[model samples]
Target: MLMMFWQLTIDANDPARLARFWGQVLGYQPAPPESDTTWWAHYRGRLGGRDAFDDRIFDPDGRKPPLWFQEVPESKAGKNRLHLDLYPTARDDSLPYDRRVEIVDAKVAELVELGANVRRRERGDSYYFVVMHDPEGNEFCVS
Candidate 1:
């Protein structure tokens, strides 16, 4: 059988709020309200309303995998084994290296204004990327 990829789920103290943060960061939107309502009902029924928190953000173009946040009591304690790498350029591969760097730096600054913290920046002979943490400390890269 062929394998299928679905959503990427993350643990958060506040699923809805975290989802909103990631939604803005990725230019995504809340998974359609009808879809979310159905899922929420199912979750609440299955869990007896005890641990029924779930929120999802979807790419506006329906291309990228949806991101899910589920409420959890425990906090993130360490770095992520897997992290997202974002390319802020809008399919503009023809941009010069310096311009690409400028775009990336501008995006990093914008994300910082939206509550992300810059961890570090890596500059190579041919490329550069910035490591940053989300509001809840999840590390992601921007290039």
Candidate 2:
């Protein structure tokens, strides 16, 4: 049997807050008819299936799967060995590089207000991206 990609889990000090932030950023809705203690959400897209993402926020106790955000005692330190890179889904070859940079810049400002810190920024002749950290200092990139 072939195994498919399930989800991307994150360890966070504040699971609920981080889950909510990511949900909004990814345009996902909270799992319907929510239950207590297990905060779940999903995003619908064409990549994997109608429900491509199954994210959850759980207490320190370990349970469930598919992007579970469990509470941790120690804080995140140093650089992230793994990170996410996001791109514009609606991008077309028609737009110029400067326009793309402007669009991504606006997104960076919005994410910063949503508890992300800019780590670095770079622009090329045809592309641009920004490295940012989540509220808990986990690194992710926006392109």
- Candidate number with greatest TM-score: 1
Please give the CA lDDT of all the candidate structures.
0.79, 0.66
- Compared with the true structure, what per-residue lDDT tens digits does model 1 show for residues 1-143? 74365679899888887887888888877643334444434434654444333387777665567778988999999889989889987647688889989999999999998889999999987778999999999999998
Clashing pairs in 2: none
Point to the candidate with the largest lDDT.
1
lDDT of 1 at 38: 41
Task: Encode model 2's per-residue lDDT on 1-143: one tens digit a residue.
Answer: 74343546777888877787776666544443234322333222222443222445222222333355678887898888898776752565577777788778899898998888999998777768899988888999998
Q: Which stretches of candidate 1 lie above 4 Å from their native place? A: 1-5, 33-54, 90-94
TM-score, every prediction: 0.77, 0.70
Minimal lDDT window, size 10, model 1: 31-40
TM-score, cand. 1: 0.77
Identify the runs in model 2 with alpha carbons over 4 angstroms from their true place: 1-5, 32-66, 89-91
